[model samples]
Target: MQRRLIASVLLGHYLSAFTALGIPLYLPRILADLAPDAPLWSIGVLFVLPTLCTALAAPLWGRLADRHGCRLSLLRAHLGLCAGFLLAGFSPNLALFVLALVIQGTFGGAMAASNAYLATQLDKDGLARALNWTQYSARLAMISGPILLGLLTAQGLGLELYRWLAPLPLLAFALVLPLPADRPRRPARAAGSATTNIRLPGDLQRLLAVQFLFSFAMVVTFPYFVPYGEGLGIANDALLGLLYSLPHGVYLLALPWAQRRAANPLGVGLALLALGNALQFAIVQPEPLLALRLLSGAGMLLAFVGLHRCLSQRSRQGGAGRLFGWYDASGKWAGTVAGVSAGLLSQGYGIASPFLVACVAACAALLLARPLVACPRELPA
Candidate 1:
């Protein structure tokens, strides 16, 4: 039963990842079609809009999930995605398109929902493993989604892909429907349960700080990555897409080993991320830069997995739905800020400048890493 539930969650996440992570890749194209005269900064703002909405909305959803059930929250998110995509696909004007993005961001947050649901069933170690596999699903999507988008674009499907992508969440919605209900029973809690008033522990606070910084460092590089590659003179779209996804490939292939061998995954991962981003800014050559990106990918796996492990340890203490909600919001907020910063940096400095900024953020996050690895004492079961 546990195995089946885990599989369902992972598969659901995999399906949702296409829209969450992959669709953003085509934002530039989508903008070109929908709002041809949109300014350069608009892409950055638009790219992060959904994320900002998610950050603001997730905690409220989390509170609802804590009161109701995570399965319902998860279902709601999928449906939200379906609606958001359809609206965006059919949008006749830029204002409507922007509204569609707002709806998308406001409603979609399946990853947090999935995490909360899994936390209800799994032990700390099991939850960690499940979260790791969830990341695997996302990484796999990161690799395949772009390649597929590139192929569809080559066939001249063009912006029609948005319409094609609309049904993906419906498929995910169907996939998650089979999982058993995971809400806490009404009888189990007092009438005035303080689910909404739960406070973050010191360790979790540190981790959230790390999450924000780490997310900012990583995401700031996303907005201009393809353009940066083009600036480096790598013109093959397919090859550029592959290079962009190489770090995730490293995560899929190397994470298991890092999980077993790393003494302090968070710290080590941050250090590597800082190093990789620094190298990316320093080195302009495509060949060596590709290899160096793997270093950053390796760091991503360790840091993220380590963070999840710490989170799992804390989930039961504060209620998974609320805690994961806050965590997701933290990361989303970071992505939002990073997007704005990336736009400003790219406009003022250069496309490559975000990588340097990312390196600095990663280094700053390294300062908060000690609490994550050291706070493993058992909480109330």
Candidate 2:
């Protein structure tokens, strides 16, 4: 049963990751199909709109999951994803494509739901391991999804086929159906529970803020890397795809080492992130940029795993869904802001400016993470 549960969770993570990345991976191609003459800045708006919707919707879904059940929430999210992707695939114009993305965001809370469900089944150590593995799956998807989409687009398969692949998550949802169900944890006093205020710890709040900054920095720079590389006179699609994926590949490779570190992993991760982003300003050549991207990927993965582990430890008391929802919202909101900012900054300054902005944001996060680093580690429950 445990093996089956783990398998199901990992599979779900992979599918979810695939669905999340599929569109963005082929955004350039999709944009060409929707609007051949669209400016690079418009791409950022495409990202911003859906992420803004997600920022608004994720918390609601999380609260619903806490009141109801994680499984039901997961199922609903997957179905929504299916419908959203199908709508995107059939979309005739950029406006309709944007609407499909909004639908996707409105119905999407699967990542938080999955994490919340797994939290119920695992102790601190197990939860950390599960979360890291899930992150690993996501990183793997990030690596493969773009390359796969690139290859398919090259083969004349078209970007719509990728959008049509939304059923993958639905299949994953079906796979999860036989896994043990988790009932929502009802508070001791129902009426009081509904009315009572729950506050997050100072450390968690700081951590979430740090997460927002880091996410903002990442989202701001990530979508523009292709254009940045193109500006550098490297137009080979495969090489560009590899360049974009290098960080995630390195991130996936670095997860186990991150999971093993005991002392100030978050600090270490943040420092690495700071260093990697700072180096981006110096590296203009393709080879050096690739190496720097790899470094950034490893650092970002370590930071992510450390932060998520901290969140899982704190959320063990209950309401995991709600907490993860807020966590997701924080990142999504940050991404929303970053998306718009990416467009403006790139338009006003230059394409490479976002990387410098990312570097500063990462340094800020590193400073904010100091309090978390000082807290004594807790044992698995």
Candidate 3:
């Protein structure tokens, strides 16, 4: 039972992780198809679509997770996302492509089920650490998914390949069938209400705000980054992939350490995210380039891992999946706005303008959490 539940819960997340990374691998292709002549500023709006869907739909999804439990959520979302991604493979028009992405976003809420499953089932102290490890699976997927997509891209795999990848979520839904049902308890306010207010409890509100600010600040690149790199003498899309991976590498390296040492661990997460954003704002010349990007990625790793751990620890009774649903949803929403704004800002001003915004947003988030950073719990967890 334990093994099945653990695997079932863990497997769905691993699948989601790959899908998240895989989208970027095909980003260049998506860009070419939509706007061969489009300015780099357009990338920000592209980044926003799924994010907007997630932002709009998360609380409702959380409520759904509370009602349907992990199994139904997975089953229902499996069918929807299956349709969504399958359609994405065949989207001839840019509008259809955007619609497909939105559909994918709507079903992304299935992740709430996975989090609730973990929060309800895992032991405390032990679970947060374990959750960190689960997150590590996502980083690991970053290593593999891009490489896989790159290989496919190199071989000229196009829409057909996406059609093939479309089955993965369905397969995941099938694999998790063995995981036993765990109907986690929820606060009456969180569960029974017909409407889910965007406003939440104070702690949840703070956490959500931090997540929003964190993603918002970092999203300045969107489509503009490739051009930024091109200006910096980057050769192709592959380098961009490597740049994305560099941040994850730093993040994976920081997780265990941050999980162990950071005070007001969640606050540390916000601070690290701030530092990363600040670096982008600070560096104008490409002379100190590689090191600055690396440092920023490390900062992000710390912030994200810290925040995940804090949320997992705090939601011991209400169920991990449910709490995570809110976390994932809020983060996605923020990411959407950031992506759009980044693109528009680049279009309206220069690419450099977005960095200034990133720095400002990140700093604000860090300050918000400063008062709380001093209270981190000790680590039997």
Best by lDDT: 1
Taking the tens digit of each residue's C-alpha lDDT, what string does model 2 give over 168-192?
Answer: 8788788778877777764445463
Per-model TM-score, in order, reads: 0.90, 0.88, 0.81
Tens digits of per-residue lDDT, candidate 3, 14-133, equal 776576557665766766865577676455456566667866776676666665564666666656667778888888777787788789877765555566566656766556665776
TM-score of candidate 1 relative to the true fold = 0.90
Candidate 1: C-alpha RMSD to true structure equals 2.8
Q: In angstroms, how far off is 3's CA in candidate 1?
A: 1.4
lDDT of 3: 0.66
Clashes of each: 0, 0, 6
- Please name the candidate that would achieve the greatest TM-score relative to the true structure: 1
Off by over 4 Å in 1: 185-200, 230-238, 262-264, 284-287
Worst 10 residues of 3 by lDDT: 372-381
Candidate 3 versus truth, CA RMSD in Å, comes to 4.6
Candidate 2, clashing residue pairs? Answer: none
lDDT, residue 322, candidate 1: 79
Ranking by lDDT: 1, 2, 3
Tell me the alpha-carbon RMSD of every candidate: 2.8, 3.1, 4.6
